[model samples]
Target: MSGNIRSSLRGQRGMSYWSLIFYISGFALIILFASKLAPGYVDAMHVENGLKDLAEKGNIRDMNRGEIVRDLQTYFMLNNVRGEPTKSVQVIRGAEGMLVSIDYELRQPLIHNIDVVMKFNKQLNTAKPELCCEPLVDLEQYRKRD
Candidate 1:
């Protein structure tokens, strides 16, 4: 009987009940936070792709500023993005080509007063259509800044 007990105890190799619960709860929190933040990233991608298409494919050479703004607003509508695009988007037409500035921030509530802010800052030229901006590259480390 004592030998049987010793064998059973040796065979039991796993986490304790409390330890398992702690790890499971921690993982659950991470997943919950990720689910909340993933949509913001998706919206940013839509905006970035829209900018790329506008700079590369759209005929902005002959279009006026109003036309450009209207087109961009329509794109936002199609992508289900909130707020006015004009608030964050700026268009400059020079002798060379059009210069577009896309700077926007997405805010999501995490705790009571604490919120997560995702900023997307990018500049694109119609003459040079390349996506160079990396979203949240500067905020890789989470720390309070003064």
Candidate 2:
């Protein structure tokens, strides 16, 4: 009877070891698959394209400042999950060209309470240069006016 009990115990140990290995392997597989599925540059791509479009159009020379901001705000609203403009798109009239700065946050995949902030800039309309880049409906300007 003792020998039989010892044999059962050994069998259970082997089963437990295999179970642990299986669990770990399963977890590793999930992580690997998730990493591949996740997109790390989704928001950055949006912001970059938006800025590029705005720059190409010449925010300083072609489009009005308010119109540029409104267009960019609308562009960002399309991809934002909260259905709101969570980013700041500013077209500053710079000495060399228009400086377009886009700042926004990207939600991380499969991770809770984490987000990535993407900021990018591009020069526009260098053909007609300005002395300094002026803000379009700047935050500080509005604050001071109020």
The TM-score leader among the candidates is 1
Q: Pick the candidate with the highest lDDT.
A: 1
Candidate 1 lDDT over 1-146, as tens digits, reads: 99999999988977889999999999998997899899877777777777766776657677777877778778878888766334777667767776666677778898688889887776666666664333322322322432
Would you estimate the TM-scores of all the predictions? 0.75, 0.45
TM-score, candidate 1, is 0.75
- lDDT score, candidate 1, position 76: 79
Model 2 TM-score is 0.45
Model 2 C-alpha lDDT per residue in residues 1-146, reported as the tens digit of each score: 99999998888775577889999999997996557434435555565565556555543366667877777787777866232223455555655545554434444434455444432333233343331222232345533765
- Summed backbone clashes in each candidate are 0, 2
Q: List the residue pairs that clash in candidate 2.
A: 93-133, 93-134
Residue 118 error, candidate 2, Å: 6.7
Cα lDDT for residue 31, model 2?
Answer: 90
